[model samples]
Target: MQLLFGIPTNKYSSLIPTTFPENVSQLMKVFFCLHYSYKYNYFSISCWQSLPYNRPTFCELYEQINKIIEIMIYIIWNQMKKVILHWDKEIRDCERVMLELTIAQNNQRLELEK
Candidate 1:
């Protein structure tokens, strides 16, 4: 998810879902900002624009950002180890539909070959 969100969206509204717990939401925002700047080459411009406010710019917030990233990684790793998981059935259903389509195509191919 972190890796994929860097791509430009067709519309600005195509953001990651914000339905997670508050802590997770905040962590995701920080992670997104970090990943976006790194992947898209916008760090300097982002930092400069944010300077007018007292907010910590990317460079200045390096250590704290890294700490947050580490915390997020630790939380996810622990959950994975415990087999704690959440499944989005909509995505699973989409996968099932694609698989059914592939099988149908293969069956059609076999019939035509016969």
Candidate 2:
């Protein structure tokens, strides 16, 4: 399972390191643009679908909030990158865990769609 995270791996860390201000700003701009695009797309669709005149019921609202919390927690978790220098067995176990999670999510989504 490939991870989406921040810290560079140890061996070739300095290979991509940059100390330029312009490079930093460029990276920030790209990140913000991608962020805004995703945010605005979700908000625009959900906002129109959930107008107050035809607002969601209490249970629906509760479900929506729970979904938001789940997404936030997932994003927060992926932002953390812990460099673990462990045995091959431990790394394999972690990969298996991540694979199981991905499969579970896909199965759940399929069930919902059906």
Best by lDDT: 1
RMSD of 2: 24.6
Question: What is the clash count for each candidate, in the order shown?
Answer: 0, 0
TM-score of each: 0.28, 0.29
Estimate, for each residue in 21-93, the C-alpha lDDT of model 2 and write its tens digit: 6875454344334453575334323422323444345676567557555766776666542324345568899
Q: Clashing pairs in model 1?
A: none
Model 1 compared with the native: what TM-score? 0.28
Which residues of candidate 2, in runs, are more than 4 Å off?
A: 1-53, 82-114
Clashing pairs in 2: none
Candidate 1, residues 1-114, lDDT tens digits: the string is: 432342233222223345456885665466556663464223322332322463345576686567666866987899876663344566688899999999999999999999
lDDT of each: 0.55, 0.50
